[model samples]
Target: MYDFLIIGQGVAGSLLAWELAKAGKSVFVIDKGNPYSTSNVASGIVNPITGKRFVKSWLMDEIQPFSLKCYREIEHDLNVNFLSELSVYHVLNSVQEINDWSAKAATFHYEKYLSTSEIHYLDKEKVRNPNGCFEINGALKISASNFLSAIKNWLEAKYCYSEEVFEEAALNESRDFVEYKNVRAEKAIFATGYDEFFLKKHSNVKFSPVKGEGLVVEISDFFSENIVQGNVMISPTMAKGIYYVGSTYEWNFRDELPTESRKSELIERLKDTINCNFKVLEHVAGIRPASADRRPILGFFPNSRIGIFNGMGTKGFSLSPYFAKHFCDSLVAGKALLPEVDLKRFF
Candidate 1:
């Protein structure tokens, strides 16, 4: 019998399992291996400066350090390098936006990490972004696939993984433990991506899934180690001269397949922003299990043998480690959860 049975091996489950095992708890995970699992296709850019107004990320000081520490520890454990400290250059479009950024810079001392420095020597042939845009300091690129695989492999080594779709019929809950198939655990944690809709029986948990589309492009020029952010973001790939460019967040769509409309929109934006040409290497889409409030939802079910750790939204890379460790602590130690992100908000 395991101490925990985790459904879905996406970022949420993977990181939570890692935290639980680190704390010496037995954990089991089940995944159906969806390639477009939000974690797999995510650009995994942990940006501290976010949104149209460029406000600081939620709890940047606390979450950033904790997540960096976790990723570094896992890197050593897995013998893989997946995290990179990269600056994000946020392009300023208008005088008003520029002023807003400058005001935040002064008010928050954003100059410490953000700046208006000009980037020199981009491969002028492949990319289309205009030159000399203002830059921000806080961005980290993570190889989401590599990091997820590392944790998955670790779970496999412990003989605690099932590569099958989780069926409701397989679950059995008692006052204390929940059982699925032969695996029994004190509690079950669901991190099932957009399928969180399946948990609506609880009534309090609400998931506002957003469909996001991305493109993997091969560009012979305009390569940089720093991440570029404007309307969308461009993260460098492991292979030379390739980049993952994307992401259009559409709240009205439920389809996870890439659409021609989104493709055209993204292509047009990229061309207008960069002023260059590149070949599209791939098109991918996933529905992020974003919550209505835009913060993660973590809490236990009332009068039930279960807990949940999900609703990471697009900032999964920034939010997962902090919440995973927090959830593990709460599970094992009966700790108090932060009220802002706790499911108590919905309650």
Candidate 2:
């Protein structure tokens, strides 16, 4: 019997297993092994500031450093390089935005994350930086595809990972433990990302899962190590001259499979964002398990051994590491999770 049975191997589940293992708990992680999952195809841009108003992300001050440290530790253990410090250039639309950015950057709290010196026009031959742009410090990029694959390989080495869909019908739960296919564990946690059917059926938790579409593009004239945030996110991939782009977040979507309209929309945005021509390399989509409250949900359903860790959404990259440790602490030491993220918020 394992100490824990983890369903899913996205960033959430993988990190949960990693943290639990660190706390001396044995884990068996099961995954459907879909490479096109949000965690794998995501641009993985851990931006400190976001949104139309350019407000700071939730708890970015604490999450950023902690996540960087955690990813570094993971790299050391796995002998892989997947995390890197990168500047994010937030494109300015007009002179008014430039002034607003300058004011925000001048503030003492925002100063640490936003840079005032780098506000300048990009090469006109490459990106369409008409009104120039300002740089954001403390931004990071996670080599998501490689990172997830490495973690899976590491888990497999310990004989703790399986590439298969979790079957709920085969699960058996007791007062203090759960058994799935004859494998028993003290608790079973669902870190299933956007596939949060368990939480929906069992609890009063409200999910506002958003469908996202993305594109892989090849811009021959564009070359930058930094992330460009404008109409569309132009993030560099591992391959030269190729980038991860688009990622239109639709609150309403027909299905997870990409639509032709979104594909054309992203291409149009790409053309408007950059001056150089780009060839569409690929189109992809994934549903992010965001909650209505926009907070992560983590806890056991009342009087049950089944627990859930879901609703990380687009910010999963920056949000998962510290919260994984938080969950581990709560489970191993009986520490309490913050109310905002706890399932108590719902029921």
Q: Using lDDT as the measure, which candidate wins?
A: 2
| Candidate 2 C-alpha lDDT tens digits along 180-295 | 88688999999998765675575478888898999998997679898888889898887889989967989987778889999999999888888887888899998888988999
Candidate 2, clashing residue pairs?
A: none
lDDT against the true structure, per candidate, is: 0.81, 0.87
The clash tally of candidate 2 reads: 0
Q: List ranges where model 1 is wrong by over 4 Å.
A: 115-131, 196-199
lDDT of 1: 0.81
- CA lDDT of 212 in candidate 2? 90
Give the TM-score of each candidate: 0.94, 0.97
- After best superposition, candidate 1 residue 344: deviation in angstroms? 3.0
What's the number of clashes in each of the models?
Answer: 6, 0
Tens-digit lDDT track of model 1 for 263-291: 88887777765655589988888888888
lDDT, residue 342, candidate 2: 96
